[model samples]
Target chain A: MELQQLDRYAKALIKEAGRKIRHSLTYELVIESKADANDLVTNMDKEIEQFFIEHIRKDYVGHAILGEEGFGDDLLSLNGYVWMLDPIDGTMNFIHQQRNFAISLGIFKDGIGVFGYIYDVMNDELYSAQKGHGAYLNDEPIPVLESTTISKAIIGMNASWVVPNRHIENEGLIRLVKDVRGIRSYGSAALELAYVSTGRIDAYMSMRLSPWDVAGGVVIAEEVGAVATNLKGQPLKFLGQDTFIVARKSLHDSLLANYITLK
Target chain B: MELQQLDRYAKALIKEAGRKIRHSLTYELVIESKADANDLVTNMDKEIEQFFIEHIRKDYVGHAILGEEGFGDDLLSLNGYVWMLDPIDGTMNFIHQQRNFAISLGIFKDGIGVFGYIYDVMNDELYSAQKGHGAYLNDEPIPVLESTTISKAIIGMNASWVVPNRHIENEGLIRLVKDVRGIRSYGSAALELAYVSTGRIDAYMSMRLSPWDVAGGVVIAEEVGAVATNLKGQPLKFLGQDTFIVARKSLHDSLLANYITLK
Candidate 1:
């Protein structure tokens, strides 16, 4: 399928998945555990993932689906058209707050991202892209970002990165926090990436994030002149967890070169 | 001035202030500083405050305006019909992100809160209340909260409270974080308080918040049966900083008794 066709379908699938999630907004949702209860897995998460998989199978039978919930195709190679989906990207946010979650999807053909979508379901925002057609919020055509310094940039990141913890030195993250223009943590990676695409946040960083957690956002983010990379300044993997930073091109080198060190 | 009249004026003024902010958002805003270069302030903050002050001075000349940016009246007490305003609450969010900030205003009559208004300009959401009449989003009357258990609640808070460095033990907050259903940090006090009032968040707590930050939110929060209190489970001082938690009365009590300890 053409990239634009994929984007159209992905956008539709995202909105449909959003409506399903929104229907559960007032329900007594069934909450469960995936990694742990703290790492929430709600019924809505499974339902939405299943919704995407069901639709993609019927509509694009040739496309392969990879999802966080164990409901999609298992693959060794991205040799064909593959769709990575994280139906409820912020399940904890969804379970607890009933908001701040998104429906995320990315379509790659032969390992090249051709389309992406992240919908802030409660807010009714849909961030969509068709590769080189550039990213968009709803219908507005968003353009590539211009330059801005780190001191003038508002960063979206959790403070957990800065304090003494697992991924990096707490002091390093704390100092980084003090150096930025402002810091915000929404606890929703898809929404934060969408915000970066929309210029609401200049950059975002997390000590560790998975492929499904950021694939759609990664595709959307690059369309806006931002860089998403591991702490070691290598390209982000589309298959595993890594310490990642999705930052402005201007600040990426400095953040990688000066601050980040392996634990 | 009559308390009812003040309520009416505050509602109108807040909506108008939201209008000015909405208009200003169309342009690229210049963000600067108030505390350090890192902490942001903006022209929109000044403009929004000036807009409210100009209207209040014309309508109720003697009513003192207590505000964040030093643009309002110098006052010892909220003795008269005092208009407490954070022209743009979450000024950092406003200056940098442009989405999470809000116009927060509260009218107190002889030390009793007569009315409160928090207008989310970008979202066009207005949360308002007059004493005894009930709180509202847009114009629909909001009901006092239904009870929710700790395991099912979503708490709104900044990580500063959860970390061990400043005041509390990291483990205490982590315990709270783990006990509660989920965590969210939206970066705006007024908005979060409004969320509490609307039942979007079961609770909101923070260690460092000034009077201007929670004054408007406290009023709205109170009307919806979300108890607003200091860490000691007492009424918050209207002058200095304190640990603030606005939650369903039951949840608020449970949090103070079970989770929070200043030491």
Candidate 2:
């Protein structure tokens, strides 16, 4: 029931996991592709996920954990204290560049996000938020998202979103891309959300993201006054994959009304 | 002229400028938009360009300079040692994010890129190459790019290139985007090119890039056995802006034959 204590524990756990992951970088990595060749999953990802699950089970025996690596429970509902964990977001970047990845963790109680933490493992930046306590990047408090028009705003997006596919209509996404100030893709959804909270980029859009991918970011983003929702301007589903866009209030509205209509 | 001496001096000068730029981040920045709202230029960009010019003029007189900030010579020919400089390659990112920008410098000997350096200022990573010697990432030798199939390669590209634009046909670029393993946009052509040299990304495509943006990258890319050329499969003009695609040999040909044909 104490949100502050829960937030503190989450941050420490994520940081410790980050340290362990970084230390293991020198060891030989066994990487394998999942789903497809582009969708890579390394042993590190599973290892870190198991590490979190073990700690959570040991510390909070009653809590439920949902993780990307399949080392946690498959809860039919997030009724009680649930921890959504993405041990190594941007695993491809970790395998190729060894940078631009993070450990994302979000804690929810009774279906409400009470604490969130995104740790940029290589950069040593911890973007964390406790409900009603606001967001902080490391020790400094992050400012609320500022209102900027589409023409003046920079966005975080992947190139696949603009390509014609089964998802949204590429024509509409292309138009949005043309009108924005700039587009950046760091290959990590969690870091992209942290960037939105920090004003590094004005917004973040992706056609498909898992619950674990956006869990930590949504909380941090909401704390910084950014709206997190699906392309249809609906609240994201916490149980599965969905289309997501997070931005300032005005920009979010404009994007949903004008560009995201075709989807 | 000793090429070794020139290469050593260029590396030192770029690294020094990088240190100065990082130090100036704390000071007040005078920012301005050029050409359009998104096209940004800052006083620090001009300051760094001027610094390079002053040093080049003082140390090696009569050398031609082609710099992004226009503090260099207006030359009709690369008939001597020419220094191509992009003081800050990602000006918008520099003003907003204070990171992801770099000081790019390339020394050409009578129209040939002899030495190249791309210094990621915030990360303190220097990607450099001397002609016939090898490419390097901060003293570690960088190996030549390995041939990769289009289906298994990650491409670095901006969203603008995939949209219906005045330059390329959107259909072809869209298809290419779909076919690639992954796509990334870092907002800096210089950094993207450096990534190509380092095998961080397999290819980098741009509709319009000035000589300074890819000069340093071109040299380093060549040292790593990656091909750098305009979309038409022709060598890039060293004197002005042009469309560019830098990739591994096989992927470069594949893109030109299938995707870049419409340009």
Candidate 3:
């Protein structure tokens, strides 16, 4: 497989998809309730996802698609070529803030990520990577992260971990929160994972995230020796939302070894 | 009482301060331990705050200054004209991410917020407002929010609220997390408030934030009939951190009346 060509084509397609989403932003778009009325999935999300499916079917007819808007096919295995899509990862931020949203796409063959791209639509930043090659942010090659202790690390975590959530215990999360240098909670998991890949924060954690949410990010993050794994310290399950942590390898081990109560 | 002049000067100063910060990002700078090594107070932060304090003192002498990094005056009461400043509101984001940081300043008199400014340093977008005048995103005037109902609103919240924090009860916050249309946590209070003022998110809820963090944001947010108060719907203290909510007036009232447990 020509990873360069795959990365280039994927990048273009992601940008075009982003443009389509941007066009819909000012069309007095009708937003509909999903999961619940307060939980939104805009017409734009469907439009963008369908757009990707249309193009991929025409070009990569052999591929399977997994998407956030449910516009793609069902798949039992990642045995063939598969493309995971989150047309607008931060849909809420997109609908409300019109910024901080992204177009995330990942290509895998036989369950291994071959090429991944995450485009920050508003700011025009493209973070892309191919297996074994270094990741690039807006065309500049991003280096692997240097080591830092947990005490000196800036940790990215949503406050939900500290509350009475169904996922992790609150006291454990609170202790981690106090032990870290500081904490940040950006609403988008994909972007936060990308941030971790680039060494912005030493770690990124969430109680729930889908495969599409972390697929592209995990591909890029792994190139920098960042561990994108579940709480059990094993590889991610590309099917459902699970408790996940993507961090510099050392930090990830230390966090799992010291904190993180699994009950 | 000349807002344009103050905004003009403030804009320029903010830009200059941001430039100094951007310049620092290019160097092989040392990350020394302040309160904590990872809890950084960079040279850039100190320099930027000093730059603003110097100019404000030279020009707006009668203006009492309250700032982060302790570079300003010792304040007993906020009775006279007060300029609350945070050279870089998301200092952790700056020290670690080099983005998501901003220069936030709010001007108040006799405890009434009069003007507010939040400049996204890397993005170069300045959100500003003067009392009685409509808020503006850069040069475009922002209108008051028109959305109603908790279900239709896009809310900004740190998910940690669901885990376990002391400011607001976990059960109450979890219910809130489920009630909002969506949630976001950008790690920067100033930008999030700017988004709230401009109607990006219908409301914003956080456990504790400093006066400088919300001072500028609340002033701009109120111009559009958005309310800024503690979760209990009480006035905000201009000294320390508190559980705060800033939202469209209707949404704010609904959340406070229907949800949000203070004890």
Best by DockQ: 2
Residue A149 in model 1: lDDT: 82
Residue lDDT tens for model 1, A208-234: 787777888888889888898888889
B124 Cα displacement, candidate 3 (Å) = 0.9
Query: What's the lDDT for residue B146 in model 2?
Result: 72
What is each predicted model's overall lDDT from 0 to 1? Answer: 0.78, 0.86, 0.81
User: How well is each residue in B1-263 modelled by candidate 2, as lDDT tens digits?
Assistant: 57778877888888889878876664433333223323333677888899899999999998989999898999899998899999999988986788898888888989999888999999999999888989999989997777879998889989888878889887888888888888999999999998888888999999889889999989999999999999999998789888899998879998988888544
- Candidate 2 collision pairs: none
Pitting candidate 1 against candidate 2, the one with the higher DockQ is 2
Best by TM-score: 2
Error at A256, model 3, angstroms: 2.9
Off by over 4 Å in 3: A26-41, A167-171, A237-243, A261-263, B27-41, B152-170, B237-243, B257-263
Backbone clash count, each prediction separately: 2, 0, 12
* Model 1 C-alpha lDDT per residue in residues B1-263, reported as the tens digit of each score: 56667667677778788877776555323333223322324666777788888888998888888888789977777787777888888876775567788888878878788788888888888888887778988988887898988998888877656555565556666677767766667889999999889887889888878778888888888888889988888887676567788899879888888888776
In CAPRI terms, model 1 is classed as acceptable
Q: Which ranking of candidates, highest TM-score first?
A: 2, 3, 1
Kindly report which residue stretches of model 2 are placed more than 4 angstroms away from their true locations once superposed: A29-41, B29-41
Worst 10 residues of 3 chain A by lDDT: A32-41
